[model samples]
Target chain A: MRNELNRVVMRFPSKSINEGLARSGAAAFASQLDPTLDELGDIRTAVSEAVTNAIVHGYKDEIGEVIMTMKLFEGDEIEIVISDKGCGIPDIDQARQPLYTTGGAERSGMGFTIMESFMDSLKIKSAEGKGTTVTMRKRLNTRRYR
Target chain B: MKLIHDMKGGLLTVRLEGELDHHCAMDITARICELIDALLPPRVRLDCSKMPFTDSSGIAVVMRSARAAQGIDSRFTVAGLCAQPMKVLRAAGVDRLVEIEEEVHI
Candidate 1:
């Protein structure tokens, strides 16, 4: 949200298959910061989690669009935002708790958990019936968590 | 996602390569189940050395795989995991139930 450095925005259908595209594209873009392999992998997994949530929880097999944006700050900081115009979470606190999932059978409920663990910062904004947005940030030059 | 399997009587070694996410978890699970049904390996080990990335869906598929093997009275283990997937599996609490081989690097 600071002074614009460089960014990429893309909108795609809320489909399961597009998750890979969203993740890989974001990883490729974030490579500009010269992130380590582990850092890149974490970023990829985090992006995948957010996009998958938009498709499974937000859209829920309904036709919708998931918008993603990646931006770079001057100090080796990268920010990613994934948004969806679909059903919003009524209880974000419960949703953030590990193993809390609406899709009981298939979902692991670790979507937000993984995103939170891998990224340095995570923020979620949502309104019932309006939409949800997940924003995560990380500094590439920081020491690796591993 | 690609799955390489070594079906030798009662032991099945499945090496999964590529990124496992929501996009391919279901299909991969189905395929692995198909092989399990046909081979009937008493012990199934998943080698994740080549699988560089995974998400919550990966956890789901792995848990399902573990359940599938248990349903057949077989042992299911995450044979090897690199750094990233290992961190995810541990955070998901899968390390408690599923047997994972240590010493795998990122």
Candidate 2:
């Protein structure tokens, strides 16, 4: 199933990361299948928030790379996995709280909240010494093909 | 996305074309804010006749624009929303904040 579907992988450094690239990447990735604008927008927002989290929270002042792995599932579900090998979040629970941010100027703390609002399912895994990984899934509301 | 602004009869009309998604929110936000600040008309109308689709982020941007309009005591009206974008906007409770009109001149 994975082989039959298309995949996109990207690695971006935190210092150079911005919203435009993240939005464009998700749009171009979803454009591979020519999805509806609403669906494409949903995917783009999720990707942007994930990448922003990596750039703002995960890396902070440290230099690191944020990797994104995207896969189309059975041509109906889109799954994206974003990982960053930077300073991991100490409290995953607090980080997911809406409007909870640690950084004063550089963060809005709505990244995860926005991602969760746009995607169907969101999963996060992190360790204090390791890194943070965010996996998001959304079902494409186009015609389903078996 | 493309934006065209017109001022007539002391009303500022903004015509938007193409998809309003997360990708275009920054530009849209900036343009709308600039127009509102610069023009300060009695009524500001958003003509979405050509808008095909919009997501939550797009809706949020519109909401923010409406709030900004309110802050300056300017009337905000969203017009010519198609079925799809209208459904999404209403479901998200955006229609409650901004006046939705069926007749909008582009």
DockQ of all predictions against the true structure, Cα-based = 0.75, 0.12
Clashing pairs in 2: none
Give the true-contact fraction for every prediction, in order: 0.80, 0.00
- Cα lDDT tens digits, model 1, B1-106, are 8999887767888889988888888788887888778887899888888898888888998998888888889998886688888888988889998888764322
Candidate with best DockQ: 1
After superposition, the stretches of candidate 2 with alpha carbons farther than 4 Å from their true spots are A1-6, A14-41, A56-64, A73-76, A86-91, A94-114, A127-131, A139-146, B1-3, B16-31, B48-60, B80-92
Reference-based TM-score of each model = 0.91, 0.67
Which ten residues in a row are the worst by lDDT in model 1 chain A? A137-146
lDDT (0 to 1) per candidate: 0.87, 0.76
Q: For all the models shown, what interface RMSD does each have?
A: 1.1, 6.0
Number of the top candidate by TM-score?
1
Report the C-alpha lDDT of model 2 over B1-106, residue by residue, as the tens digit: 7999898987988888976654566678778889998988888888889886654445666777787789789999999997666765665567887899997864
